[model samples]
Target chain A: MKLRRIQAIAVKEALQIVRDPRSLMIALLVPLMQMVIFGYGVNLDIRHIPLCVLDHENGQQSRNLVARFAASNYFSLRRAAGSDREVAQALDEGDCGIALVIPADFSQRLNDGGRATVQALLDGTDSNTANIAAGYAKSVVAAFSAAAQLDAVQRRGGTLQTQTPVGVEARVWFNEALESRNFIVPGIVALVMAIVGAQLTSLTIAREWERGTMELLVSTPVQPMELMIGKLLPYFAVGLADAAICLGLAVFWFEVPFHGTVATLLFTSSLFLTVVLCIGYLVSVSIRSQVGASQVALLATMLPTTLLSGFSFPIEQMPAAVQAATFLVSARYYVEILKAVFLKGAGVVELAVPILCLALYAAVVVVLAARAFRKTLD
Target chain B: MTPSAPIVEAREVSKRFGALVAVDRLSFAVPPGEIFGLVGPDGAGKTTTMRMLAGVMRPDGGQIVADGVDVLAHPEQAKRHISYMPQRFGLYEDLTVDENIRFYADLFDVPRDVRETRAAAMLAASDMLPFRKRLAGQLSGGMKQKLGLTCALVHTPKVVLLDEPTTGVDPLSRREFWQILYGLRAEGVALVISTAYLDEAERCDRLALLHGGRMVHCDTPAGLKARMPGAMLEVVSPEPRRARDALAGQPGVRGVLLIGIGLHVHVDAAGRSAGIAAALAAAGVPVSEIAEVAPSIEDLFVALLDNAETPA
Candidate 1:
């Protein structure tokens, strides 16, 4: 492959890109837009859940218990219901995500130093938020009960150890609060690479065919390898710039912590970019129409990266067969690397497997893409 | 036709598309400094022949050689010496004409000094110097074709294969394109041009008349016209259509073609003019003028195709 031919193609492609500034601007900005949208939109933290309380006792102890639930951040007490009928009506009318009900003897039972039972009713429609809200509610009630038990112990002057015999201390390392944003924002970088890289390069060869320029292009002395490299070099650089922007948004804008070294990040991201760009090139050569090629590129790259790359769903939660299939998706390794680098302070040693897998995938697809273009019209 | 070796030659090359033969056993040789024309109607394998010569299409049989390179075995090697312009638009529309020319010069690895002089000369000859900064997409059809030729010839390849370079161009542009081609010929560049306009074939050093993917006649413009077995006579009549009707199957009449000027009647020999006059009189069609004329390549094309269609 002659460098002159490759340079010629690259120069022409650069002119084409510079001549149409709108598409380049869009390609660069779409990733940042997606990052912002996904960072704020796919938030997993469910806060300020509306709660309705039905207290039949109307006593001090019952009021204190209601105040405990209201003080927590997870629940926002909407309104107090009067009776059993009101409680049922509140739950039916979707007035609250969850409801708390206390019986008429609740103050008496608690004052007599005996056990008191209350009912916590929850909405099951939005199961994810409902589940999280249930956990939050349980923690609140548990804390309140512990305080009540300690008070009784102090009243009897019993040993403090008897109040809490066995308790486990849990510490979360990566995400201190186990925030889902950490999980979400890092994966957005992988998605941006998969989507924009493939979308832009997918139109290269197919556009030439659609515009009736490939015939003359192939008639030259340019080899397929030279042409592929020359056509893809500009887009590959664009993809890396896109990666930089998305990474900046993740770290500087959204404040997702990044712990990996810049070298490893760039190297691995370049590998991933190579894979997606090659995939787009292969599709462009196979499909002659730009519309068809871009659609197939989205299907082949964006869909897999979004759905099967463990971006939204955890790969460990997937079935065994699907987990095995995730191995084939190039973005899966990138997602793993993203999570590791962002959350675990993982460097090269901790990320050898994913890096190797991405490199191998890049190598194979590059070969396929290079071999895909033949000079013959047939 | 030259004493020296052929710079580009095809030996019995054939190309087929499934059940249809696009080019059948076509053979020709183009020496340096000659313009070889592939003259035929649409679907007569003109484009296919040009493509094979360009090394873009692989022949089903036989071989093509360009500048000591086996085109079938190594198209890339052959492409160094061959510049092909497709029948359709073959330029990047988003780029300016100058940029397009520079891009081709880069592709062909032309030196800066050579490219600068050559590109400027070509643009001046084609009257495209002022429009060099214009985007290729914004140019007129004829101008686009001219830019395509400039780009194709920028590399100064040994053999230039142009497929209907003026198919959709205006008549004036077509004449200009031919002038540029004559300039290339003067520079000793071998040109293989394909066109459906038989009148354009008159300018070629030699012509190949293709019909149904086969070369029915291959010779000079005058040589191919000389192959017509009968004489062509122009008849101007008051009722030309009726005269054509009366002379449809007259003896010694080969073909009757209605033209804008008059009816072009082909007779077997000069002596058969009396028979045509008598036939028109019997049908009560008054012939205002009757004159004998030399057959064009178009006339020879029709006559040869008719002969090929019939049995001995």
Candidate 2:
């Protein structure tokens, strides 16, 4: 209950963080680097699609098709070859994103007023990019059909008419621009909290146990609950500080919108951090050695946060069993909470489920940590 | 010397960690302002007993009372009367010396003015004044141990438990550390210290010899020495290794330990030194000189362990 005691402990802990540059790098520098990499590395909207053209027929129709592909910004003509094998090799080597082949019978079919199908091959290594490439290729073919019809109408001089087609409208919610930064920065904030908060608490408590300092503290008039709360406070501050920096960068630097209240964002992130720190303390108290504590802490935080947390993958899209397992990942709900607050500007009523889940996680972890800590020094 | 009542007492206390019974039915009491020594080697449960008495751990069986307060029942209340410095006495290596002391003082809720002056006096007594501004981690091993002791006693507890505070310290630092403990004893503080060095145990007002989770003996150093059935003999010879081999398990010879080139043999104090000389001479081992010596704590410990056939 004494502020001075907590302050003393917090000051010591913060000094340790300042003294160790490697921890600072992991806590601060890495978040920024991740912000930039995840911003660009994880894009769903593919641009400057590469396509190899194989035109076996030296006719006007084939030339015109190649021109259409080159004229559009979506497809960049990488290489023009006479053999299908060459274009396939380009796709195999990842030199081109897609390949277009116009056969030798393309001019004969066009002259005979018959439909000639041109082959398009796309690489599906990156499913997102491959999907975008497929859509763009279809649109290019549609545009080519409309241009050919219009040219036919001009040649026939009002006898033939090119008629209308269907139109579609698109609207995006949450992130209208769908900038990957908006999606990734929030997740990076959660990840940073997990890594930094877990490591700080693990080292602080485990080192005390190893060095025999906890015995002194236990022998004092300090209550176990007081000690646990005091230790958890400083690390909670560190996690909150890192989250603030991440949020600031996401908003000002990356231009990601923060539609929700800052207090709500801070409070939700603090709950996630509390859960992480409690897990770290539990690991520290259970294991006597710092190395052992660190290994357990890293595995405990990283596995759940990365795989089951729905950070990179959507839980809804996963298997039913995986979706069921996501409930066990404390950070999964927190990541959702972060996105909702930062991107969607969700209010407390709208995010009640995730908030409640986080509160439950925090309570369970804190109780377990206190119990483990009570028996550690002995 | 009105025989002050026992300030700390443990009756039939026992603790077992899985298959290992670390403290077995150990009972000891430390009167006020006395230095009680718990002497044992590694894994001998010295730390376990200290932890129990310090109220950091509850004994699996039996009761521990510090100043009439049940250690297990009201541990936090009992802890207010004691300070415990474990084997690797914890120090905040990153913080300045002043900060480490202040942190402990704050934990114990020491008032501002009293804590400030007490900390200053403690640092001065331990000869750590000039180093108050230095980082604890950067201090030498001995200095760090002293700093740990200072921090432990900053709140002026009635009893202090030190778990081998000088195990790895040099002989000079060990002497200085004992001097500090003696000073604290003079201030009416009950001091319970655990150590592996039998020689250090000689300085205690009373010693508790522990071996294999059991107390072998508890008495004053001289009293334990008086219990030894034989007198320790220092035997000098040109061939000590050969002398030890020849004297091994010989009649009337209880123990033979190598001290440099000479072998210290324990024998009957009533007998003449000539008997051992003659015994070694008849066994074809050369003996230069033999003299009867007083039994040290080490000698008493060796004799007791040998008599009990327990692994020392």
Best by DockQ: 1
| Candidate 1 docking quality: incorrect, acceptable, medium or high | high
DockQ, candidate 1, comes to: 0.83
Among these predictions, the greatest lDDT belongs to 1
- Report the poorest 10 consecutive residues by lDDT, candidate 2 chain A: A37-46
TM-score of chain B taken alone, candidate 1: 0.96
- Write one digit per residue (lDDT tens) for candidate 1, span B1-312: 444578899999999999999999988888888999988878989988888888888899999998888999988888988999999999999999999998888888899899999989888887889998999999999999999999998888889899988888999988899999888888788899998777888899999888889988889888878788879998888687888888887888889888777788888889777788888889999888788988877778888888887854
List of chain B TM-scores, one per candidate? 0.96, 0.94
Q: Which digits, one per residue and each the tens of the lDDT, describe model 2 over residues B95-183? A: 88998888888888889898889888878776789999999999988988988888888888888999989877877777778888998
Look at candidate 1 and tell me the lDDT of residue A226.
90
Encode model 1's per-residue lDDT on A9-59: one tens digit a residue. Answer: 998998898888999999998988988887888887888898899898878
| Count: clashes, candidate 2 | 0
Candidate no. 2 TM-score: 0.88
TM-score of each: 0.95, 0.88
Fnat by candidate, in order: 0.92, 0.79
